[model samples]
Target chain A: MASPRPRTYAEAREVSSSNSELGWWVFMRISGLLLVFLVFGHLWTNNIVIDPATIDYDYVASRLAQPGVRIYDTFLLFFAMLHGVNGLRYSIEDYTKRPGRRFWYKILLYTVSAIIFVLGTMTLWAFTYQEMGDAVRAIGATQ
Target chain B: MYRGREGQWAFLLHRVSGVAIALFLLLHVLDISLVMFGPDGPFDAFLAFYHNWPFRIGLLMVIAGVVYHALNGLRIILMDFTTWGVRYQRQLWYGVLGLTTAIGVPVLWIVVPQIVGGI
Candidate 1:
């Protein structure tokens, strides 16, 4: 079984076999604090300020077109992905019995998370959402 | 170890919610990234499929998970950082649950009708 998580910095230092593990313990608390606001703001805007059912391509395109939204979402994407992926790693370590299974599970998890992060970043930055929205609308107009 | 007490239950819920949210985050990112495929892409169709009531309910569950996880996360932070934290950990957990429900009630009030209307 995986060892118990540290309850304090002192305990962490005592129990942590390596600096990297200590760093992650610190990272989880720091990132978790930030994500509280980042995620709550995201949910409030997407779900409360507007009906999620009404959200579609045009809505997302218009939102993403704004520079502020892009920047905000970029931060959200990075922090949420890192915090979440690390949390999953903790779970994998706790639940998986076989060392080989644990290693492969983490490998698969990291691979998929990396791909999604790249995809999300590209979605935010690779093309101008305004132009993409207009281009799609233009196609619809003619057809 | 917290044994079979509230602290243990809090730890269990935190892990379950963390795993659920992480898995959902992966899928959520993938679907939102579909917007990169432009208007002609499957983004709209995929979103429409999610707009179904069942998925809408699932989204509610996600929101609940996010709320509880986020609040309890703060509780964990407090328990780690402050001298008074360990002393008050159990009381703090009760606070987390109370606040999660308080926040969730308003959220459900606002979102539930939208889901119902779409049906």
Candidate 2:
């Protein structure tokens, strides 16, 4: 027999805990709260405080050069990705009723999420502004 | 139970906002990653294009989505953890609406003029 649907959010939470959905539920709540602060702060800094017209390469490079900014951005990246991926996973499960299709869809979702997360992290930390500047200068010298 | 019209709207808004932000995050990640391509990269070019009027409108929507999602998410947490929260969920929902509007109005006031003024 199919399991009965949860009648309330509380019931849903209980069922989720018994199953494996509890972790994701808790994560969504926590990450959602954090993203509120992180994302809004980010918007305030980039879009409000700084002149959007002035946000060129130098501005971006200088902003990311700070270690504190990097750490804050890394945390934002990680939490946002995980929260979004899990939310999408839930949506996939809800939409895809068939077991086999659901399995494949989740696999694809996870793979893409992982790739995006890795790429974002690398972009945030793999290179310094000085390194990028030197590379640009070297390219210009080669011409 | 979702309980009322406001509760139902909150639920819907939360999901819709979550999905919208997720899609935005995908593009955001890709755009930021362009910085890795070096100083002479297409990143600045992309940002220039992204700063145009149309994209700014799109970003306004994103800000709206984030505001709703964040406030409603906090309401959900409050309901989950507090003793009398479930009993007062409807009130909390109203409070969330009030708070979102309070924050969103000033945000638009500050951001829209900047965008319309060209960047």
Candidate 3:
């Protein structure tokens, strides 16, 4: 399709502004770059080198015990959430154009994003491993 | 016809793939934690789980899911941000396939050698 003609001064604001579009452009570029490394490193560690064939509880626990792996994971956790949230935001923008809808959508997005971020952080950090597994295993067995 | 089934299929596949990967991630964490705890049997149990063909296919499907979810998300972002991107959504969808496959090849490269070695 051919590009649309330039908008008049008043018309420019009436149409979508480059300012907001530009913001998304910057976001896309930055997230895209971060995703490249975060994604590749995540894949390399998790899939390639780790050898899922040998992956088990202690393997993961020891890895997480390391300051480096923990730090790397926290970054992955943060960036994955950020990128996905930004994506959802853009999706809402695509389907809903009404101001009321957009406003409520943003509110909902922020709320849900916050809840997920909190939950993800909790799991990434405060996750109590083996807190219940052996207990359940014991209950399942007879003395 | 193309609009209806294709959109529905795309949405369904995206959801399916997402849930698949998320489940894998959850199980992965639990399995890792198990390794941390029992340190032996639990790890062995994980190996046992992989021996099942259904689980093997399910795992591959999870990789496919990640490929689709991440690429589809990119397509959506491009459509929203770029000036002419939406107009080229179909082309972009194909581009995602190309990109996903290209990146995915390396992953498959690793996967194939292992499967071959195992066979």
| Index of the highest-DockQ prediction | 1
Per-residue lDDT over B1-119 for candidate 1, one digit per residue giving the tens place of the 0 to 100 score? 43688888898899888888998999999999889768778999999999999999988998899999999999999989888988898999999999999999989998889999999
Poorest 10 consecutive residues by lDDT, candidate 3 chain B = B32-41
**Runs off by more than 4 Å, candidate 1:** A1-4, A130-143, B1-3
What docking tier does model 2 reach?
Answer: medium
lDDT of 3 by residue, A18-103 (tens): 77754554565566557657766887786778555555555566676677877887787676666556666656676787989998
- The true-versus-predicted C-alpha distance at residue B62 of model 3, in Å, is 1.0
Measured with DockQ on alpha carbons, how good is candidate 1? 0.71
Question: How far in Å is the alpha carbon of B26 misplaced in model 2?
Answer: 1.5
**Residue A68 in candidate 1 has what lDDT?**
97
Which run of 10 residues does model 3 chain A get worst, by summed lDDT?
A1-10
lDDT of 1 by residue, A43-75 (tens): 989999999888998899889889999999999
Taken in order, the candidates have interface RMSDs of: 1.7, 2.6, 6.7
Winner on DockQ between 1 and 2 is 1
- Give the least accurate 10-residue stretch of model 2 chain A, judged by summed lDDT: A1-10
True lDDT of residue A83, candidate 2: 90
Segments of candidate 3 deviating more than 4 angstroms: A1-37, A77-143, B1-10, B36-43, B51-54
Name the docking class for model 1: medium
True contacts kept of 2: 0.63
